[model samples]
Target: MNEAPNRNRPAREVIAGDRRYVWHPFTQHGTEGEPTVIARAKAATLFDADGTEILDLVSSWWTCTHGHAHPKLNAALAKQAAEFEHVMFAGFTHAPAVDLAERLVRLLPGDLSRVFFSDDGSTSVEVALKIAYQYWINRGEPRRTLLLAFDGGYHGDTLGAMSVGRGSQMFKPFRDLMCQVLVLPYPATFEGDDAVEEREAGALSAFQALLAERGQSIAAMIIEPLLQGAGGMRVCRPSFLKRLVETAQAFGVIVIFDEVMTGFGRTGTLFALEQADVVPDLVCLSKGLTAGYMPMAVTVAREAIFEAFLGESFDRALPHGHSFTANPLACAVACASLDLFEEEKTLERIQAINLRHRELLAELQRRSDVTRPRVLGSIVAFDVKDIGAYQSDESRKLKAWYLAHGLNIRPLGSTLYLMPPYCITDEEMSRAYAGLIEGLDSLKR
Candidate 1:
């Protein structure tokens, strides 16, 4: 995009166009001011139109796995585009889609063998919801209709996704329109929290109580497993997750793990499910699926769940799909991203990142201003004590301070966190943590 005038337009003109035309997500343009016009990015750094360099500590919203503009990913995308860009996946198939699905199936834990493609994370969750619901219908249990979700869990922005994620408190406007979802407590824990076990025990009791009342009527219970991304990067214990999944399954409730943000070495492993050693009936994957090179997602269903949808009539068919389902370009890049994991020992990189996070978070937590400091794989998060809502004066000040310090951090209300990509270097990590301390110091002032 550096060749033409339109491609490399001045930041002022781009900002003017954005202000006039583009309605951005999670932004109040009038007060939030001009968005940075990033011209390009590499590894863990972003280059804006004004030539300012910023470290992408949030992996560009937790998608850039290996890095931005990776060579292997670029090659895969370009090669696939020249061969076969896209084809309808309903009636036909291609190597990239099949290959990617196989790779993911092998990488994923348990008997997750069926891959249903979608455009993004939300659509992937929607697919899982429809499939999980219709699975009972096809099995002659149409009465099993109510969906379940954990408190402080977020799936996506779609209607069905929002229904399950309603407890996140970001879907107030659409509450009346969303389907009824049974909410359970999430034992959101942190480092040095001695009371987590008590909360987990209470959560288990509450979950049992809910299931006892409506277990048979519930179709599926969706959770974010170890890491809940949009719900403030809140983390829970793996032992607790394993127990939750087992309890759900014992009650015949289909469990869905929403690993859209935690998959592909984000949680110090290939998948978060590995740490829990529990398999769900359905799992939603995206964000890092194509390593931030393209928008792609898949809801991998257990063979049993998939078999329920297999019948003679189209009525039993999963009546959901995006126009670009299993887009060849995306599949190709995803396949390449998976390859990079083995070739570059990405999981090991995630381990080093995790260790670095613990070291920095320990130092950060010493400050009186920070609390509930936690680290999960490459992600580190903590709350700014005595802060208010998502759009408060404290939030604005923190955002501005981070931006001024060349750190691309978007704090979740009072919760501040980092989810840098696996390719983030030592220098970038130091700078990001330094910025974190400086921002907290400014808060003290």
Candidate 2:
């Protein structure tokens, strides 16, 4: 009985094995179509089992900042693996993690000097949530358990993250189990948005009322900064963010900026907080932290907030950490990715992407099918009109059509968006926009 004669031999076998046992994240296997098996990938392009090249428009869920399999990051990962793969991070320190932490501190704003390692975006949010809760408790305010977040903001899928991301509709089944989190209106704005003042005032009034009533009870206020990614890529003004921070701070509520999606030059700055000149008490960062090369996240806090958790007694200190905390390989790749920001001028490339997106938005405005067009740095999005399905069937149809025509785009309900890798070429961008227009035309007929 030698394992049924070892029949598993080919690529198809591997794929079949995946289909048999693998349960994918954020996907419906019963109703939705089968997953496309990717074989190899490179900068801005992914190859399927049949070697069909698909231009990654959404950057594989808005990661892959420099692109897939970037040489520098790959080399760094290999070097680090050869030297030291991983080490338990409780008492030991590694050069890669330490250097990466130092680099992040310099890049971030204000006194966000302390970094706590984690595995992904959800854990990062969890870390921030825990830190904020304990920071108040450590300072002798154990009654402050209320957490505040914006409407239409999607944090992550963990219990704490989902509590803050109630507006995203991703956790309907577990709605009853999440902790208490208050949702405030988000003043989402776009091009030629003159009603922002009114919306901001209304939001401020609501926030003020909430703070006045529960200001002493609230532990922290977390936000997605200038852009809400999973909530239809809804962007707000920098002034709105600044004002929101000020309002939260005035209430003595700890401020946590969920920069998981907007970090690493996605919003025309290294960090979205820099664009608004706002200093949050804690910042949750992931996504492009390793330039999409590895899974890593950091919850960095201001010195004052970090100090709240310090004490001689074990019970007084924060006792949360992941097994893979500060994994050396992830840290090494992250360091290399940061280096590319300076060596390859990544932010400048983002500016070029932004310019192109602006030009595309101007042209897209002429098309009747496109509505509420918005462009933020490398991200461009618009809703397709008269598609009947909107966020449901229409979005699926448009996505399938795009895939058939050699593109990878995942639309949010009625919204079609493009957040291509920074290494995407001008010709590719033009082709992607052209394909989108063609999809809209087909939908019209």
Superposing every Cα of model 1 onto the true structure, what RMSD results? 1.7
lDDT (CA) for every model shown? 0.89, 0.88
Which is the leading candidate under lDDT?
1
Q: Lowest-lDDT window of 10 residues in candidate 2?
A: 1-10
Question: TM-scores for all candidates?
Answer: 0.97, 0.96
Write down the lDDT that model 2 would get: 0.88
lDDT per residue as tens, model 2, 78-124: 99999989999988999999999999999887899999999999999
Screening candidate 1 with a backbone cut-off below 3 angstroms (N, C-alpha, C), the clashing residue pairs are none
Model 1: worst 10 consecutive residues (lDDT sum): 1-10
* Model 1 lDDT per residue over 293-375, tens place: 89999999999988987878999988887789999999999999988998999998989999999899779877888889989
